[model samples]
Target: MGKIVWSVNFTLDGVVQDPTGEEGFRHGGWFGQFGGKDLDEWAKALFAEALGTEALLLGRRSYEYFVARGWASRSGEWADRLNSLPKYIVSSTLEEPKWSNSTVLKGEAVREVSKLKQERDGDMVVYGSYQLGRMLMEHDLVDELRLMVFPVVLGTGERFFGETGDKKPMRLINARTVGDSLVLLAYELVRDA
Candidate 1:
């Protein structure tokens, strides 16, 4: 069985919206505004890992955004393999997946992801699907988490964690400084027996 992993770029305060120029968040393009040498180095490392993934589990919005230009438009092994590897999207309204080597996951998101994890053969990664991420976290479907903590805070925007009825405890397995102030945190969900 393959592990379900989440890789999300966030602010120091945990905001995941547009931080650069104007492409990240839906409203303001404040995501990459603070990207410097450190941020670049951090991004390179993150993309390297993302490239090694065998599959991508995305929400409807992320699926559409990624497929809009096709994964091949990007460089490196990740882009090449992503274009050829399997992509599973959780969406009810998306009638079809236009991207190559893509599949639309129907039915309940949590159940489908659980089933996929049980049968998958390699690394399965998920990007910024807050809704699906929350659902997966609630059901205890995720195995690993990679958090790229940025330097700035947007005060308010989309959040990585939401009210999922309870707090989920995680065990940190790895921690490193990527670029400048960006912190890359790798953690595992602690399960109670």
Candidate 2:
């Protein structure tokens, strides 16, 4: 069975809105301010995460942003792996997805994801799909959660965990500081074990 993995970079205040300033967000670009060994380690961690991802699950806004942000244009092993991977976008309103190996999942997200979790594929890595992530989490479909938590706090923005589905218990499998202040945290949903 496939596992749905939700991975994202978040601020200390739980904000996961736009990290880059290009999205016209007033408080964006906070993620790029860090550098040195910490940044390097975090980047390496990101690469490792991508390497393990079998597919990508994204939302409409995030899908457009990723394509516009030129993730496909960037030439490298990461770019190649990222762009070539099967991408499933949960958007009832989206007509066509231009990216390679991209599919627009028009069915209800929760039902579709439940079916997806039963597939014989590898892990399904979710990027910046806030609404979709919420739906999946709310439906108890997410198997693993990863957060690259930064040090700064943004008082206002869309948060990563504004509220979980319910009182779902999570087991912290791994937690470590990636850079100067960024912490890479991994948790598994405790359904049984």
Candidate 3:
């Protein structure tokens, strides 16, 4: 069985809007704002994480945005792995996804993901799809929560963890600094045995 690993770059205040600044968000590219050699090196280290990911799970908007934006134009082994990896996009309206190795999952988000976790193997990562990731957490379908916490906080923006009513209990699995400014936090959900 596969683990649904929810991963995102978040502000210390929990904002997870547009980290790349491509979406024209007012406070976009918060991750890139920290300009330093340490930040550059930290970003380069993410390639290993991409290589280790078994598959990607995306929400409709994020899936469409990635397909039309950077990921479609990017190249090399990193791009190869990303583009070639199986992507399961949760979107009721998206009947046909144009990206290669992409599937549009039109079923109920929680049910589809629960089924996927049972059927697939290895780490299935959800990157930057806030709504989909949120739904998974609400359903108790997520196994791990991995966050790259940026030093800066946007007082107003779309939050990574909105008002999801579940109020889950999580145990800290790992916590470490990524660069001079950012910290990586990994948490495993605490479930009843």
Among these predictions, the greatest TM-score belongs to 2
Compute each candidate's TM-score over C-alphas: 0.89, 0.92, 0.91
State the C-alpha lDDT per candidate. Answer: 0.80, 0.86, 0.85
**lDDT for each residue of candidate 1 in 61-143, tens digit (9 for 90 to 100):** 88877777566466666577677778899999988788778888898888888889989887898988878888888898888
- Candidate 3 lDDT, 119-156, residue by residue in tens: 99999888888888888888898899988888887898
Task: Give the poorly placed runs of model 2, Cα more than 4 Å off.
Answer: none
Name the regions of candidate 3 deviating beyond 4 angstroms: 22-25
Model 3 residue pairs with clashes? none
lDDT of 1: 0.80
Q: Kindly give the stretch of ten consecutive residues in candidate 3 with the minimal lDDT sum.
A: 37-46
Error of 3 at 128 (Å): 0.8
lDDT of 2 by residue, 41-116 (tens): 9878988888998999998998988898788678798888898899988999989787888988889888877887
CA lDDT, candidate 2, residue 83: 84
